[model samples]
Target: MKNKQLTFFLMAALFLIPMQVKAEQVNLYAAGSLRAALGDVAKAFEAEIGNQVATEFGPSGLLRQRIEQGEAAHVFASANMEHPQNLVGQGQKGPVALFTRNNLCALAQPGQTVTTATLLDVMLDPAVRVGTSTPKADPSGDYAFELFGKADQLKSGSTAILTAKALLLTGGPDSPKAPEGRNLYAWVMDEQKADVFLTYCTNAVLAKKELSGLQIISIAPELSVGADYGLLVLDGASQEAWRLALFILSPEGQKILGDYGFVVGGLPAKP
Candidate 1:
C-alpha cells in the first residue's frame, strides 16, 4: 500500500509541474542593432519554453514611442538606458536592467584614409563627408551627438561645424536605404555619398563581413562614447517576460551577445 501511495504522489507532482510553467505567449520589442544576437537568444528561450516570443525591431527611441502609445509588449530591449529608465520613471515598467554595451566606430572602405585620432578632427574636416543617424530617433545617433557635444567643449565651436556637416543618413525606415545589415554610411561611400559612417562597432563588424575591405576606425579615446543596452519587463506582464529578461542576463545570453561584438557588461573605460 505504501508503494502504491508513492507512485500516485509521483504522478501528481509531475502533473503539478506543468501548471507552474508559464505558458502565456509574449511580445518583445527590441533595438534593430540587436538583430543577429537576440534572434538566437530568443530561440534559446523558446526552446526552453513552448511559449512564443514575438519580436519587433527598430530604432530604440521609435520602439519607446510605440510602447508609450499603449502598444502591447511583455518586455522591451533597448539600445540605451534612457528609454528603459523613462518607462521606469513613468511607472510603466520595473527597474531597468543593463545587459550589454556597445561603442561607436567609423566604417570606411579600405584606403579611404578615414581614421583620425580624434572624431572631432575627423568631423571638423570640411572635406570629409561624415554620416550619422538621426538624433532623438536612434540611440546610436544620440551617442554620436553626445560625442559632438564633447567636441564642442574641447574646441569651442566644433559641435556646430560637425552637426552641420554630418549626413543624417540611416537608423529608421525613412532613412535612405543601404543593405539591411547595413552601414548606410558605407553604402554612401560606395556611391560616393559620404567618406565615413559613424555607427556601432558591431554593425561595422557585420558590414565588414558582407563587404571585404571595410575598415573600422576607433572613435578617439578622449571623445569616446558608449551605449548601455537595457532590458525591462513591463509591469503586470506575464511571467514569461521576466523569464526572458533573466535569461538575457544569464551567462549563455552574455556569450551570445559577446559573439555579436557587444561588450558583455559595458566596455572597459575607454583607456
Candidate 2:
C-alpha cells in the first residue's frame, strides 16, 4: 500500500510538471520598428516562463499581411495599432490590446546643412534629395506621407515635395516580386543615396550613429503621426501560444515591454 501511494504521487507530479511547463510558450511576430526593444523583452519573458518565445520581426504592414494570409502566428505585436485593428476587423485577431506608444522624427545624412529647423528648407531645396519607404508597404512610410501632408497644410506643397523626395517601396522579403527587406533610408544611411530619410524615434534610439549622424527636427503633434504598438492572440495558434500571449500581457509580462522602449499598459481584463 505504501509503495503504491508513492508511485501514484510521482506519476501525478510528472504529469503536472509538463502541463505547467507547456502553459508558457508564446510564438510572436512583431514589427521591425520594435525589434531592438522587443529582444530584451523576449529574453526576460523566457526567463520567467521557462518556455520559449519565438519572434519574427519585419515591417508591420508586411507582418499583418502575412497573418492575413494564414501564417500560423500565435501573437501579433505591431508597431502601429492599425494592423491589429485590421486583423480584428477581418476576424483574424481577438480583443485589441494597446501596449505602447512612440514618437516620430526626421533622419538626415552626416555633414548635411539641414537642421530640424532647416528640415523644411532642405525638403524644399531642389539641391537636396530625400527618401522614405512606400506608404502601403511600411507604416512608417505611410506616416511619412501623412506627416508631409500635414506639413503641406502648415506651409505649402510640403506634401508633394516630401512624397516626391521618397524612394518608395512596393513590397518586403515575402513578396515574390520584391523579395527583399525594404530599407527606404538604406541608401541615404550607407552614403549610396539620398540626403534625408524619415525614421522612427526608436530607430533613432537603435541607430543614432548610423543614420547619417541625424538629429530630429520638431514636427507638429497634430500631424496624425503617432504609433501605438498593440498585441493580439492569433486564431488557430497552439494552446501553448495562447498561454504565452497571456503571460506577455500579465504585469510581469508588461514590465518586460518597457525594457524594449514600449510604453507599457496592462492587458485588458477578460470580458
- Each candidate's root-mean-square deviation in Å? 4.9, 5.3
CA lDDT scores, all candidates in order = 0.82, 0.69
> For each candidate, how many residue pairs have backbone atoms clashing (under 3 Å)?
0, 1
TM-score versus the correct structure, for each prediction: 0.84, 0.78
- Give one digit per residue, the lDDT tens place, for model 1 in 76-191: 99999999899888877478888999999888757676555655676677888888887888899999888888887679898888877888887765887766655554466677
Q: List model 2 lDDT by residue over 126-223, tens digit each.
A: 87776665576667777777778888666787778767766653235433232254333443455545566666766654555444455555554555
Which residue runs does candidate 2 get wrong by more than 4 Å?
1-25, 169-188, 209-212, 218-224, 238-243, 246-262, 265-271
> What shift in Å separates residue 66 of candidate 2 from its native position after superposition?
1.4
Looking at candidate 2, what is the lDDT of residue 222?
53
